[model samples]
Target: MSAFTESALLKKLSELNTSQQSIQTLSLWLIHHRKHHTIIVQTWQRELQNVAEPKKLTFMYLANDVIQNSKKKGPEYGKEFSNVLPKVFAHIGESCKSDKLLGSLGRILNIWQERGVYDAKTIADYRGRLHKESSSSAAGAAGAHPVAATGNGNGNGTTKTPSDKHSKVTDKSEKREKRKHEERLSKSKRSRTSHHATAATPIVEPAAPAAEPENGHTPPYLPLGEPPEPEELIKALNSIENSASSDALVRERIAKLPPEISEISCISKLEDKEKAKLLANQVNEAVDLLNDYNARLAAEMEQRTKLAAMLRDFQAEQKELLAQAEQRLDEHKKKLAKMLGLQKEIHDHLSNLPDLTQLPDVTGGLAPLPSAGDLFNTLH
Candidate 1:
């Protein structure tokens, strides 16, 4: 039988024993022989299968050694076999620790060593071989040793040594120079386009001087003076009212008069004593209007401030409510997930039960109902 099948059978036998000590002893023997042998034979078979010629022959010789040693030890020896199992296991493990098989067994032994099943020295040896193989494979891929048959070299038909570092540096410098050249070209193109656009646009000059005023006609400047008597001013204002343009011009001329003249012109048609009384009444009315307007403005501003504060408060409350709503939604989703999980568990439990629809009713076999006196006696 193959080593794999033999190992599986031994494992099964060890599982059959119930005593802790017996199980341990049997397990130790099985592990030393079948378990270790299975690993070595599998490793040898894989390595030898791909090689041609002498390498294959070497693998066969190694495999033969393991098989012969296992046979000489005898298969299926009982408790007496335990005495020599460790030494044989160690020898087989060392044979498999070669660089050829290290990759396959390195990680495996490291795990075993971590679990206290293998020694530290064996684990380190296997790991070291794996590292060496990785480095060698990397060197081969990088074309470190070019063969004469491949003809990979300089154009002059001479084989060249690898210089990866120099090639990498040259590539980087070329990329940087290319980028800088592209930037300079782009900036020059932008500047040329802007200059052409400016040259194409039309420039507008200022308009010619306005036509000179005719006949040296200068506008008459009003002279500041005391206002005319009320009766005279009233007559003058009435005469100008007939012409719209003359009336506007007259009003403008009057505004340039002294402040006292302006006030007198406002009340020009009234008598002196009557005008004084009217002026006092007008002052009181203006004061009342100003006070009322100020009061209304203050109230409106206070209302606006209150409304703005209320709006801010409402926005804060809305945010709180939204947060509460999100929390509730999360809680509901959790509850729904839990309910679904519970429903699935219930469904599985019911599915396992026998079909109750096909069963006969046994309710008729139940004892008859007792009276109140029987119930009292049973309780007593």
Candidate 2:
């Protein structure tokens, strides 16, 4: 691991901005030096505490990016950050008046829970600290509670002494007022529900925010293996010619090995020393050729083993992609079916309507109008 220095870390944190590029660049560096995760997290917490309030949210984004992207490599960063995140949340909550920033924190916390980044209890603890801090800040902003802060008749923060009879009357008045408030709320709720159920217009949903690239550039695809085509694999396989099995000429020569080299009796029967030496030399040459061919075969076998392993990995990733594709296909099919059903409903509703063109005209006297419920409530 490279040397870990607090100054160096502090420098990077100081240079950090709210941009995605800045956050991602820092996260990449942090993950690269993840061996020093404990120290990194400590330094991060210290910087967050000391940094100006406005930059605290930026620091939070950096932590989130690091913790999430580093999961596959190791869990050290996540664990260390989790230990400090409660304090980080509280600090941000105290200093941050922006509901948007606190909501982002809550969203990050939810993502952690969903992704199994932290256990339920740890997340709960973090959430509690966040809630407590947010609640205190909100209360402080809104000023103190009325009952405690308001004085009795005097400006001093003290309650006015009242007789028991007056106290009873005041309590009854408050209860009656509360009851009336509840009744109004109940009636409003019922009216809203009935209006919603009978509404004729289609409810339009809010437009979702446009998607942004991860690094403010091209979006990254998932790590699904993009294996080469079968033709490409075939060409590659054909290009590998390191072994005797790939050479027909070498195979033919091996098939025709002389008995002089193949048989022990043939070598022993040679009586002349020169002849024996010559035979030995010839055998040695043949042996060298075979050994060289065997070495080539060994190298070729190693290559083949590697190719096999690569193909296995590629296939596994392809299968995962295939499963995801199938799921998407199912969802799209369901959506298509729903759309078709909606079209049919529209046609049927139109057919049920009384055509104004075909209606009998009453020029001298007006005809009674059709009941509105009969037109709309037909779908019910």
Candidate 3:
């Protein structure tokens, strides 16, 4: 088992086929990471919801494989799947009325019941939602994987159209001729005009995949946009010390300001003509300094708040990178282990074989059979 990401799981699900190898391999991975049963089931449900009707049965086949196989090892996957299966059944049962699908569903339900994959009540619920009466040989018919009805999943790895998934491959020229004929019928009653118009319209080729980023360029983050570094942020915060909040002398000046400058109740202190002018000058200067400082403080506050948001984004991007790296590391380790296992298997098999010297001496043994190449080595 390797690090399991939801995206990897979704990719695996999207590429899934009806082959026992495909289903069982994915099943084993899911069961190994059964602690993520919640996410696995949720991803499964989402995939089933998103696929075309024809391909939907493969998703169901996946669910059946995981549910039936995950039992005995741990019931977590089966239990988690149980929560969403009714909805899955309803979603699948409505769109898929294929007799093949119905028969498979019935057989699956029967297998589940016989194996006690789910409790009696749950079994009843599934039967009510998806079971269909079919021949008892469904298990035999389906062979190993329940989705054998799918023939070969998408046959040639192309996506299946909305029609039956098991349909035989149609000739491309036949389809093209039929489409052209339909176009002629739908046009102004002249066949030549329709033929000319259709001939003039070029077939649109499928678009090519986007080119990979050149010169080692890629997004700075797993998601778009990077945030300022801690060093840059610290510099920005230090620059904000020009603010009143960080200015001890400015705070002291504010504290020492006379009340007569701002208080109407203390206007009696400014009764003299010259003294009144002095008081007005004092008030004007204080107001100018305070107003300028207040504006700077507001701007600083806004900048600091934005910086906090950037910090949050920076942390999120870091976590995303770490998670991606961890997943890759686990996958690498798993591959390495598998390689070592294969190497050991090869060594063990070779050790079990008799070397050339260990053969029965061949002293009295019958002469070995000659090869066809040996006869040809001599003159004919």
Off-target runs (Cα >4 Å) in candidate 1 are 1-271, 344-348, 360-380
Q: Write the per-residue lDDT of candidate 3 for residues 1-380, one digit (tens) a residue.
A: 45799989988888887654465557657876888899889988988888887567667667776676556567798778888989887766556656445544554564466457777788778755653222112333445344433555555443333332222212232244344434533442353334333543322211111112337753111111234567876887677666557888877898899888889876775568998888889999899889887777656655555555566546654564566578779989999999999999999999998888866676787888889999898757
- By summed lDDT, the worst window of 10 consecutive residues in model 3 runs over 202-211
Q: Candidate 2's residue-wise lDDT over 1-380, tens digit each?
A: 12457788888899998764566556767887898898999889988999887677678778877877687678899889978988887777556555444544555565567567788898878766655654454455435434445544356663433332343443354355445444644665565445444643322221111112445654221111223456656665775754545887877777787878878889668989999898888899789878887777655654564455446535654564565578678988899999999999999999999989987887778967779988788868
Q: In model 3, which runs have C-alpha deviations exceeding 4 angstroms?
A: 131-380
Off by over 4 Å in 2: 1-3, 137-380
**Cα RMSD for candidate 1?**
38.5
Report clashes for each candidate as comma-separated counts.
0, 0, 0
Listed per candidate, the RMSD to the true structure in angstroms reads 38.5, 28.6, 27.2
Ranking by lDDT: 2, 3, 1
Q: Is candidate 1 or candidate 3 better by lDDT?
A: 3
Task: Put the candidates in TM-score order, highest first.
Answer: 2, 3, 1
What would the C-alpha RMSD of candidate 2 be, to one decimal place? 28.6
Best by TM-score: 2
lDDT of 2: 0.64
What TM-score does each of the candidates earn? 0.24, 0.39, 0.35
**By TM-score, how accurate is candidate 3?**
0.35
TM-score of 1: 0.24
Candidate 1, residues 341-376, lDDT tens digits: the string is: 999999999999999888788668966799999999
